[model samples]
Target: MSDWIDEIKSQLPAGRVLTDLADRSSYSFDASFGQYIPEAVVQAKDKEEVVHVLKVANRWKVPVYTRGQGTCLSGGPLPVHGGIVLDISQWPREIEVKADDLTVVVSPSVLTARIDEEAAKHGLMYPPDPSSAHVATIGGNLAENSGGPRGLKYGVTKDFVLGLEVVTPEGEVIRTGGGTIKNVTGIDMTKLLVGSEGTLGVITEATLKLVPKPPEVQTLMAVFDEVRLAGQAISKTLTSGVLPSKMEFMDKACIRAVESFYPSGLPTDAEAVVLVELDGHPEALEVEAKLVQDVMEDIGARETKIAQSKEEAQEMWHARKQVSPAIAQIKPTKVSEDATVPRSKIPEMIERLRGIKEKHNVEIVVFGHAGDGNLHPNVLCDQRDQEEMKRVEDAVEAIFEAAIELGGTLSGEHGIGTMKAPFMERELGKVGVSMLKRMKDAWDPNGIMNPGKIFPEEGQKLVLRDE
Candidate 1:
């Protein structure tokens, strides 16, 4: 391994290859759990550097885990197998907005939020707005196929992508899709690679599709004395011929957590609060906002507050975004899982989550884009206590079981990285697993691209021990 790593270092620029212990240690872990130090780290600033690094890795049959700004919550960038950490986050930032084409081309290192900001100047919008968009690089979002509140009406990252510039595991540069929005020339490799979790290839550049910005927007918040009623309000609004741009839910635990951290003036007494946003023509928004308000009131909402100004509306959404960081302050370790169920089964899922917290003696906070049934169930626990972590492990498994039992997936927006690999077979049968493996084998014949992710090894299990 050292001999091949030396060979890679010799070809790149002097500062590109990093082998010091301190540098290698920094590349060991990501936002997710578990840390395995790689033997080397290469900050590839361009596609040529990536090609050189991949060719050397393939020659040595060493795993190369590509990463961006390290904002992925699903362990997508963890170098568990220990080889090379290909960090492309330093690539030259580029976002060329083709206003006439209603499209944008960006480099892999550009932040996801910048795309939308650039589009907004042209009276256009990029639909996929992940919570981490402000800091997370677009490459990481592309790897995980991330979604956000807007996913309720618009689609996810995979839907807005039109083309990709990828480098195969064998160090071959290939183009999937093109600048055109409509392309059916061959198999849709762009979609295949977007959510493949970086096991298929390393994305160097991407061309994204954009839509016209909505003319008007309205915001409403419904305070629910019962959490079940909040879930009911989400489903009712979707079924009542009213499609909101964003519908978010936060439980009492999450509401108090945010208030304690940021003091957003949220109602700490309510069991849950649902924030809804409608975007369209001004006249249509006036009518739809009324319909959404009526639905929430009919479903037993205690109070419904409509924001009269844009600043107030932004404050509501900011509180919703603060749940993750605010809850992190409660414990030393936080296990965040996006176990999504059907919209109709959300109430049952919430009930099961509450029961699991009591059953395992763990503090779990719930919040997320409830309009799409994708809820974030975060189990807050200290990792130093081995016995408590054991209970937390069981609680996570039970939550996965509950989602699958409800005809939902183990992950809604997050990818099946190292955290959820062990449960792959439980959701997808043996045959389904095998078929996916065949595709992986075809692309990554050497199996050197992001090993130890998405596919479980022999007798693998979920263990959050700090050993």
Candidate 2:
């Protein structure tokens, strides 16, 4: 073992440091592609423990990868050049809600869903609802700037974060932002670190902003015969002055997959389904619901179903939630990409995705928070087949190109971990990426924090298959 590992063990409590191969192997892979076994895994339970691990790793110039629940779909926490995996998921969960101030201070280990659940008791709500809220930790969500259906109206994790207590790469503790809503005291370091994919620092605690729970929420499902029509309906409804709390899109492939997996009453015959949720005063939602319905019908929706009750609405959403798991049943491996475009270009983006699918001859399933133009286009394939995996990699690259061509980003919510590193320059260009690297260098001078991420290494390419 290295001297840094010994030093970390000396500082942290016994049994918190794992050097066994079995224990190390457990942290090798996350929900995303690639696997790398770290030399050691350190379970940090508090700020002091995180500080010690980072200090040792930084002193030795060893890479330190911060991780939460390992539910990252974009390889955010994977230890590519691993020395120590700082596992904060084991940290004691804390969710302290200050209802009067509409803010919640929480430990990084707290599950993202629990924050909202705690806030609900105070008649408040945490708006950033990532799909993995129940399984993923708040630290991971904050690191990746995760987004979900609610992101259309409420924004992503970064927007809700009012303050953060993060440990710098060299083990320096710093607090950015504060409990109040407005804080322009200095540089917006909170925003910079939130979506940094753990390249800059490790977050220990966070203060999240909450909002009063909506009085009423109405759900509507719009079924379209043509995929493009569904996209048009989403764009039209957003412009029609009825902004929904949640607007999700799922294509025929996703619908059929859900029905096959969970037997939801989704119309498998429809080419696409646009699920909309409007929340506000009951009276306003009633009018907004009608207006949205008219827009959907006018835009060529064959059938528009308004959720009659909360149960009905839950059922509709339950089906939408099943899209991911259901689609996974189609193939052994799923390459999920959140390639987002502008709202006006949604229809065209859908058309382009279709073209890419047909051109590449791959099974592509599309679904996501479409109201924000963030579409999750998944490519299903068997990784065992190298020939097919190569094609899948090519198809994924083409998908990134298509999104950038349409004035969109390579990633909407998922941060640029190893999966999207190679394409950073494609979207940001050389100069933009260089500026980001300069900022990163200024933050972590030794480059021991989450190495081999965000900024691409020389000659790096997206390789999903083994050598």
Candidate 3:
């Protein structure tokens, strides 16, 4: 292994290959749980470097885990098999906004939000705005097919991607899709790799489609006496033929946490708050805003507050954005699970989360894009407490089961890195899992690309505590 690593060193630029235990330790883990030190760390800055690393890794049958900003919540970048961590975060940021074509070409290392920032100059927008867009690299977002609040109106990363430059598991550089808006030519490899979690190949560059930026936007907040009512409000608003730009939800625990963490004007006494944003023409927004307000009230909302000023609206969104950090302040560790259900089942999912929390004795905070049914049911706890963590694990499993039972998915935006691998069979079934395995085996015959992820091993279970 050391010999092959040495060979990888000789191919790349000086100091590009890091052999120091301290450096490898840095690439060992990501924002998710679990850690495994890699045998080496490759700070690949260009496509050639990526090709070189993959070629050497494939030849030696060494596992290669491609990583970006490491903001993955599903252990997407964790080097579980201990081979190499190809760190691409430091790769030069490159973003070229083709305003005329309503598209953008970007290097994998570019920050996801930066693409939108550049697109804004041309009155265009990149709609897939993940919560970590400002920090997470586009490469990672593409890998996880991450989604944010805007995903309610627009789609996830897979929907916006026009094409991709991927380094195959065998180290061959291949291009998929094109800059055009529509292309039915051959297999859709671009979509295939977008959410594969870096198991199939390594993404070096991507061409993304952008949309016209909405000129005006309005914000509305609906206060509910019960969390279930807030869920109903989301379904009601969407079914009212008033598709909001974003519809977010936060439970009582999340509301209080955000207020305490940032001292926002949120009503901490409310059982839940459904924050809504409408975009497009100002006049049309006013009309749609009223309709949304009516639906909220009819759905049993105690009160509905429409922001009169931009600052007020921003303050409302800022509170919503503060949910993750706010909840983090409540506990040392957060088992953030994005088990999404049908839009109609948001209330039922909330009910299930409450029951699971009570049954497992875990402190669970529920929130996320309610309009699309991609809810973030986070279990807050201390990882140091083994007994509590065991409960948390059970609670997490129950949440996934509930979502799947309701015709939802194991993950909405978060990839099934390691946390959800154990249950892949439960959702995909034996045949489906076997078909996916065949595809993976065909792509990476040596099984050297992001091993021990997505597909579970013989006996892989969710373990959060440091055992």
Query: lDDT of each structure?
Result: 0.92, 0.92, 0.92
lDDT tens string, model 1, 299-406?
A: 999999888899999998888889988999999899989999999999999999999999999999999889999999999999999999999999999999999999
Candidate 3: tens digits of C-alpha lDDT, residues 1-467: 48888888887876878888899888888888988999999999998989989999999999999999888999999999899999999899999999889999999999998999999999999999898999999999999999999999988899999999999999999999989999999978888888999999999999999999999999999999998788778877788888898999999999999989998888889999999999999999999999999999998999999999999999999999899899999899998899999998988989998899889999999999998999999999999899999999999999999999999999999989999999999999999999999999999999999999999998889888787
lDDT of 2 by residue, 1-467 (tens): 78888899898876989999999999999988999999999999988888888888888999999999998887878889978898998899999999999999999999999999999999999999998899999999989999888999999999999999999998999999999999998889999888999999999999999999998999999999998888888888888877899889998899999999999799889999999999999999999999999999998999998989999999999999998889888999999899999988888888888888998889999998899999999999998989988988999999999999999999998878999999999999999999999999999999999999998999999998877
TM-scores, one per candidate: 0.98, 0.98, 0.98
Clashes of each: 0, 0, 0
What are the per-model C-alpha RMSD values against the true structure?
Answer: 1.2, 1.0, 1.0
| Model 3: worst 10 consecutive residues (lDDT sum) | 228-237
Give me the displacement of residue 146 in model 3, in angstroms.
Answer: 0.6
List of clashing residue pairs for candidate 3: none
- Candidate 1 vs candidate 2: the lDDT winner is 1
